[model samples]
Target: MSELNHVPRRPLIAAFLSLCCGPLGQLYAGRGKRSVTLAVVTLVLMIVAAPIALWIPGGHVSFKLLMFAFACWPVFLIVDAFQCARKARQQRLHWYQRWWLYPLVFLAYLGPVSLISELRTVFIAEAFLIPTGSMHPTITPGDRILVNKLGSRDDVIDYGNVVVYYSKGPGSPLYVTRVVALEGDTIEIRDESVFVNGKQISEPYAAFDGELPTYPNMVSMQPVVVPPRHFFALSDSRRRSMDSRMLGPVPIDYFQGVASRIFWSRPRQIDFSVSPENSQIGAIAWERIGMPIR
Candidate 1:
């Protein structure tokens, strides 16, 4: 009877570790080889899938698939940990022996995984919230946008491309604006209308809050040639935006990424200038959610 009966195992503890840092519970349950295998597989999948999903055409579909895979990964680890704990109990393995291993296992398993995830966010892509109406009509003050850090890699930054760049000014460190002129292009503003290479460009995305032919006292400047490796950018709201006209052309190195799409948006009280105040209580703009930014 003693040989036939299985010792009891704590399923809750196993599940907690697996969910917190995948496969860690398996090691705790004395399934060392299996835990190592699961960790390697998860890391390999992320390494292979992330770049493909971000860089290739029709990659959004692959990205969705990868996201689904990630969602399932933790669940699989939890189930495996529970099952392994049961097996270890059945095999009459001591549950609490070698207690010193827990600390080492945690540092080895969780530390590297956390570092890799952070590095991915820093280099691959990330999201940001729009706090101003500068890009209004296209992107509003309460919209959350995804920025693809790899968007400009191996590609040319063309006119009309919306980008996010690090600003060295007093406001936010990052600013979102549209590229009006690329390297070697001539840009001039006449009465708020943008002229590139001596030709007036059509700007359907541009918006003005009030009935005004042009922004009053808007600085008018002569044609200026964009220096190499730099870009001239402006906001859609010509009247309210502080852009290249005030800061000069942005350097290529200052660029952080390109705006991919609007993930979320909300309409805030018109009077509130602070972002947190606007988000406190507001109706969701369902129509604007998931809207793609051009």
Candidate 2:
């Protein structure tokens, strides 16, 4: 009788691999078919969950709950992997269970995931930290936001959309402002009020300082038509904003994206304790998190 050719499988190592990548533990346990199925199922569920959550009211909370459940998926995989490893340790080794093949498979899986992540960050959406209170009342300093990179086109942009665009030059830093007028529309500003196409537009999000206004000349403008492929933008905090009235109409190509949501925020201070003025400083602003931008 031929002697059995058994290869040892360490349960701890299998669990660790599963924790790193959900399907990796199953693969290490010599259950290649199960590994593939689990990976596929996880991917499909995540893809489906996003849109479903967005369709519901207060979807950000629902989305977070769904993600928390998804996060626990690896824990289940880890337990299964540990059991599989213990059971398979004394069994005859399969032809595909080569020691070096595990690393190769891990690398193969990692490559595509990394590529997709990079592509999404570049073209789909990216996060940014607000550096100034120019858009004050609506968006404040220390706010971390997600910007939709696909809304740069003229057809997709409209009044009231908060946008990130380059000013001065293409190489200059990005500026965040709200669209006040679109191409071919006549726009004017009267002190703190804004007029578009001969009508005063309501701007509930705008902020004005009672003391005075910087660039006060910018607070008022003679009606001017926005040129083709150009649009006018203004900051919500008109008192301190340097926008279209100062930089002129922005070209369509200058836009980067539309500000989508405030994902996180905190007071920008050294100490995260109660301030001398009794205001909470350096602490996370919970109310701002997951807030959608108009």
Best by TM-score: 2
* Alpha-carbon lDDT, every model: 0.73, 0.77
lDDT of 1 by residue, 1-294 (tens): 123233455777777878887887887677767888998987776555545444544433544555577678879899989888767764654443244766677788777777777776778767788877789889987887777776553274678989888676335478899999998999998877889999999999998664343433344667889998889998997777778887878888788778876656775444434442444437778677656677
RMSD of 1: 4.6
On lDDT, the leading prediction is: 2
- The 10-residue segment with the lowest total lDDT in model 1: 210-219
What is the Å distance of residue 199 in model 2 from its true position?
1.5
lDDT of 2 by residue, 1-294 (tens): 233367788999989988887788888887879888887776665444433432335745754565477668777889999998998887776665777888887887777667656666667677789866678878877888778775338655788999988997589989999998999999987876888998999999988853465564566788889999998999998766679888899998888888877767885532213432333337788777767788
For each candidate, what TM-score against the reference?
A: 0.77, 0.80
Which regions in candidate 1 have their CA more than 4 angstroms from the true location?
Answer: 1-7, 48-69, 86-88, 94-97, 151-154, 169-172, 210-221, 263-292
